[model samples]
Target: MTHAERAADFLLDEARTDWHDESLWQVRGKRDTIVHAIPEWEALRQLGSDIKDNVLSNLDTYLEQFERQATANGVTVHWAKDAAEHNRIVHSILARHRVNRIVKSKSMLTEECHLNQYLKQQGIEVIDTDLGERIIQLRKEPPSHIVMPAIHLKKEEIGQLFYEQLGTDEGASDPQYLTEAARQHLREKFLAAKAAITGVNFAVAETGGIVVCTNEGNADMGVHLAPVQIHCMGIEKVIPQAEHLGVFTRLLGRSATGQPITIYTSHHHRPKEGGEMHVVIVDNGRTEQLGREEFRNSLKCIRCGACMNTCPIYRRSGGHSYDHTIPGPIGSILSPGIDLKKHGDLAFASTLCGSCSDVCPVKIDIHDQLYKWRQMVSEEGLLPKTKTIPLAGAGTVLSHNGLYNIMGKAARVALSHAPRVLVYNGMNPWGKTRELPEVPKESFKEWYARTHKSKF
Candidate 1:
């Protein structure tokens, strides 16, 4: 099914859809409130954008520099060209360590690579230690949102999930009680974990350190306890210098959750004593995306999720509708770059209102990129018949001024005098939610000529 069909499934539950919309909009409001108080928010965004530009422009030099410095710091760095190699590298390390069970913090890169499923097939019991991740993991569902994986689920649903899986009291939906239940449930997994995996928020070339940001500090716990630790980082996550880190850090929290900073921004310089620390830098498709001129700016994403929080379509449709690891406006652009034929429909799932671009921490031109992708989709003949047929007619009418005017006149006549059934029917999705203003009898050009000719 296309994005619209999947989104229709989400919209079937009007109550849930409205609640979901309000929940994310509340986060967006919180983000606006916190950011308004900051004196240098825009400046910080510009600085972060500049730093990312520099990093993307010279990513190779920085990667080699990072590897050298990291190796010097007693950290082992491995490179993977894509998801298969990435999963293989991770599984090989686990097999070498004889790890039967492993714990992981919230890692979207791993989700993109489907690492948990791969590990499970290899008979490794993967436990997600982050509370939201653990909820979805137990339920055997993919993350709906990048930061809030279980945001699509309600507390009552979680209560039932915990009741079934964690043995919490039936129908106990209180937030604190459920949190305590999760804490007790994950503690054992953390203590027994043989290896821990985390996603990198930023990797610094100057100091050869990787930083993991989280509100729950699950990544810190898993890394500190496990003897074998792996930090899975996308190649685009690298930065040029340690100083460039602060700019992103400043923008991340306020834009993400209205906080001064994430609760735990842990830095990993080296492994724990007698433990193995592996930094797996995987390219999956970053180089391919970077080579594309129109979409490369998306690499600047800090994963703060501010754009997702503010996006109207994402708020109402839910992230799962996008059918990608990272969802919302940023994902709409990035997903298509990876497989335009498969994800082409996502490029049209927006209002092109630029709200997402406004809230992005690193200032990615998200909506513009979505529009570009839409054009690319049309160029590639990727649209379905429903859209392709109408757009073909629209193109002809819009290209010539005379044809556009005649079509406009015809539309006015139809909308004005046609039967109600003709105007409101199965084909017009736009009329489902709202109606247009009354059709005018005269065109703007005609009105201009008649009204202003004598006076002006």
Candidate 2:
């Protein structure tokens, strides 16, 4: 197996532990009750999903309209077809400004495109300003959770990481003290950075502005303080108008962290007085995804991450297990489209419990996408050898009543004396951590004939 596959398998193995998986499942349930308090919750979700769908369907026209409007407002707009194109566009902007050091707010697009590494390779220094992202960055690891990237690391682990990296006292483990220490350290970087890059949470097509939601005010601080500000957004992130912002903002934080809303929701219309502003609208396979009717709705994701927080598979396996920048249920569905053969296993990682679909603020039908991706991936010959034949045979048998009855009888008889361990081979992914259900003798149909039919 390849390194990526091993990492994925290891994550899946870890997810099978009951305590680990069930915790996130509870978080999902809690979020549902919170959302249920609002009567228009379902309507808001449909509206949000509809808006995104409309924008994605008319993506080219909206993108062009956004570019024209953004340009008219004195904000430069650049288009990138892929990751390399994205990096070059960003690098060019930074190079033009002679910016070597940058302070960045949380932007998943950057992580997805490996922007930090690319900037480092270009001899530019980048600092992740989000507290969770900062800690993960200092440790040289990818963010483990979407909103709380450092969720996997305990306070003690963070203190240790900080003490080693920031030259703090050896055992300082208090969260407040550590937070202040990081604040002071980042304060210096914030004051010094010539440029700042932020991710666009929502872009308003009507106004030609970008909306960013942040808790720490880092995105505001970075963009407001820096001489030059750059914002990167997926092409599908554009909303029709500013009026729609209220619907998304209401759902975003409540679904994500259970907060009523994030502390700061900043809109950038033009550059800070005399500062330069640029927006890099990225396609990066989003348009291709939009072309698929069955899967296009996945683009409605507001990145609330409630799906991840509530996902049993995500909690058990953790984000790093996905081996992609975006992790959890959303990542599993999204990754296969980017590279089907390499990420094929991710589609099968879920139990199809539909919990993720239930928690999504925008109601992306995440579980449905996961299911569709499985069929599409299998058709593309991405299925691993062992799964292909048996599942296909089962499908064929289940389609015919007589064949299924014969197969059921044979299976029950074969399983009657079979060793428990034999049923759980290495080939069975679920068998690694979960016990197989015991097989009972005689078919339900046969039992019904023996009991209910005679009575009738």
Candidate 3:
């Protein structure tokens, strides 16, 4: 289904829609406050953007460099050209180790590759240790938000989920209680895990180290306990130097959750004694995306989610409507690159508001990329006739001055004198959630001629 159709389904719940919108806005406000406190926030964003651009421009060199350094640090590295290969490589490692169960921290890359489902199919039990991830895993739902995987659900909904799955109290809905319950349940999973998997937040070529930023330290716990550790990262994740990490660290937490820093920024350099560490660097269509000059800048995303929190369209529509691992404005641009035909409608799911670009920590031109995707989709004859036919007629009217003026005057007259029922019915999508403005007596062109003619 198209994003609009799914979004319509989400909007059916009026109270939920309002709550989601307000909740994201509150996070946006928090970001504004925390970011302003940093005197060099914009500078940091620019630096992060620059570093990502440099890395994208020279990904091949950095990826090789990282592999060399990581190998020297006693870390085994595997390269996968696609998701299938990445999943196979990871499964092969588990199959070799004869690992029956694994615990994982939140990793959008794993979500992108659908790794958990793959592992489960191979009969290797997979448990997501992150609280939000665990909640969604038990419910068998994809994450609705990147950082807050269960943000789409309410505490009451969670209480019910826990009641059924975790055996919580009949009506217990307190955050602390639920969290403790999750922690205890996950602790068992962690200790029993034969292997652990994490997503790499950043990989430094200089030191052959990867960073995992988390508030709960779940990644650390899983890695520490599990004898076999796997870290999955996209090729774009590699940076040239360790120093470049500072720029992203300053911008990431603030943009993602409006905090000065993540509670635990754990750097995994190598394995513990008698333990094994594996880094899986997967292309998974990233190389193709980087080849598109107009869209290459999108690789600069730090996954801070500032754009998602600030986007008006995303704030109201909810992330599930996007139907991609990454959602919101950034996903609109990225998804189309992966499959234009299936995701074409996503580009039009925006107001073209630059708020997303303004808030992006790495300064990706998200809205501009959305516009480019829209042009590509339309040029490919991907838009349905319902939109194309009306747009074609509007284009004709807009191109001719006389036709434009006539249509403008007709609209003003109809809006002024026509019955409210005629104006607010099924034909008017804009009227569903908005009021028509007061009609002006004259067209701006007409007023301009009358007033400016004398002056000229």
Cα lDDT of model 2 overall? Answer: 0.86
**Candidate 1 similarity to native, TM-score:** 0.97
Error of 2 at 397 (Å): 5.4
lDDT tens string, model 1, 18-67?
A: 99999999999999999999888898888899999999999999999999
Instruction: State in Å the error of residue 83, model 1.
Output: 0.6
lDDT of each: 0.93, 0.86, 0.93
Badly placed stretches (over 4 Å) of model 2 are: 1-30, 392-439, 452-456
**TM-score for all predictions?**
0.97, 0.91, 0.98
In model 1, the runs with Cα more than 4 Å from the true position are none
Q: Please give the ranking of all candidate structures by TM-score, highest first, separated by commas.
A: 3, 1, 2
lDDT of each residue in 1-456, candidate 3, tens digit only: 999999999999999999999999999999999999989888888888888888988899999999999999999999999999999999999999999999999999999999999999999999998899999999999998898888889999999999999999989999999999999998999999999999999999999999999999999999999999999999988989988887888888999899988999999999889999999999999999999999999988888888989999988899999999999999999999999999999999999989999999988999999999999999999999998999999999999999999999998988899999999999999998899888999988899999999798
Clashing pairs in 1: none
Per-residue CA lDDT of model 2 for 217-309, tens digit only, reads 999999989999999999888988889899899999889877778899999988878899999989899878888788888888888889898
Winning candidate number (TM-score): 3
**Sorted by lDDT, highest first, which candidate order results?**
3, 1, 2
Clashing pairs in 2: 15-316
Q: Which pairs of residues collide in model 3?
A: none
